[model samples]
Target: MLGDMILRAFRLTVRVSAVVQSSCQCPALHSCRALHSSPVLWAGHNKWSKVKDIKIPKDAARARMIAKYTMMIRIAVREGGANPEFNVALAQLLEQCRNKNLPKATIEGAIKGAKSKQGAQYLYEASGPGGCMLLIEVLTDNNTRSHQEIKRIMVKHGGALCEGARRNFDRKGVVAASRDGISSEKALELAIEAGAEDVQETEDEEEKPILQFICDITSMKAVRSALESLGVHTLSAGLEFVSHTPSLLNHAQLETASTLLEALNDCPDVVRVWDNIHAQNSQGN
Candidate 1:
């Protein structure tokens, strides 16, 4: 989507901005003006703000996902077996951990603890602004702590937790993949043939056009099986939100929002941050 392209452009511009700000010892005023006046720099900053206003909730969401996965791994071992070959969820989590390059010892320890039956399970939730929705995957022995943290983050970020957010999320599972050399139509066909509910494009300046497919939760396994049956190379595959309306931001506000989102994202508990921050054309917010 154009939003993804905007994000990539924003990131690149930010890197360039950082270089400019760092190398210019000539005058502080001159360097600041360059940052504010540069077209690319301004566009990037604006895009970032839109993302922050809508996409990112706070750090707590990530922290929650990590905790939930940890608990799930523990539960998987205690109930089925430590060896992933016999435990599907454990195997999937293991695959995810491996894909993310998580420490071997960490994965092993989670399994071992699960085998000991010393782990507790936690539920995940989503929250958002008035019309925004957030999906939060969390893990915690103390539900109160998790809930409070999530609530705090939402309030701090001009959003809140509510039962309503659940309505915005499609329980149907979705997977994201990329087709660098292929056209968007081709990617859509592959996904549809695999029984995908919907297919959307991804925007990446340097990479191939990315596509995402939505399928029934039960059909997700089938979709993956079919994709594998076709031998397609997917850049990423996971569940994500489909925002109703993407948000927008001004240039100055965008910069501030980007910082807020990054700060919140840096929190360990946060797992995934999604929002509709880019849905307009403008020079400022």
Candidate 2:
């Protein structure tokens, strides 16, 4: 009887050990399968996801740039005439569009749209973060809709539409040029000769060097012509509202202000957005 009981006990221990071993093996198999199957799939998925994320913003920015140029073309032709030869503004705008790789057909379509009274120009002003001001230019067929949309965006982005915000800015001609091949001294001399009020050198988001020439609003054409005659390529030459007293913001305030500006700029009707927020490191009130 004692021998039989001991044998039964040994059998029960074996059964329990087998059950535990099987449970452990099941998890090991599952883990092996997961590890082997997921690395390649996850890596590929992650790579594609990153590409998609980058491409989306780039494509959207390109679209916005095209749309802004299109609107400017339409406004130029409408205010003047479709004949580029007779309309200097339209001619300049056409050249600008071409520089941006805007399609010929798109330019022509914008001109045609202008003739049909498809849209009107509007200027909006709002107070943004850190006591900075914004000047938003828009072209839209519906004034009420544009106003409501712009107001909503401003309010949502920690800004509010304010009256007479333009008073804080000076309307002037701004000419932006790349400093790729031009020396600072040469740029300053040229700007002074062109009757520019100020010549400032700055870097773009990519840290590319840029030179800006500020002049009286009425002197843009002359300044632009002077630069072109000297074989200096201008990136952009147009009227802009520059802040007289720029507001300095901290990093957090700058982020919020930048977000608001980008949101305003992404609107289809918004052509350009100007702000009085000083550079990140600048000291201002």
Top candidate (TM-score): 2
Question: TM-scores for all candidates?
Answer: 0.56, 0.75
Model 1 error, position 194 (Å): 2.4
Regions of candidate 2 where Cα sits further than 4 Å from its true position: 1-47, 181-190, 201-209, 225-231, 280-285
> Who wins the lDDT comparison?
2
Residue-level lDDT of model 1, residues 1-285, one tens digit each, is 999999999999999998888767558768777787798878899999977875575344444445545665776676678877887656766776665455688777777776554324443444443344555655345667766887777677666666655555555566656565767787778887888887777643223466667787777778877876776655444445665544455555445445545544454444445554443356532
Error of 1 at 80 (Å): 5.8
Can you give the lDDT of residue 165 in candidate 1? 54
TM-score of 1: 0.56
Query: Candidate 2 at residue 166, lDDT?
Result: 91
lDDT by residue for model 2 over 75-179, one digit each (tens)? 888788899898877887787776567788888888888877677898898899888888889998899999999999988989999988898899888888778
RMSD (CA, Å), each prediction:
18.1, 10.1
User: What TM-score does prediction 2 earn?
Assistant: 0.75
The alpha-carbon deviation from the true structure for residue 268 of candidate 2, after best TM-score superposition, in angstroms, is 1.8
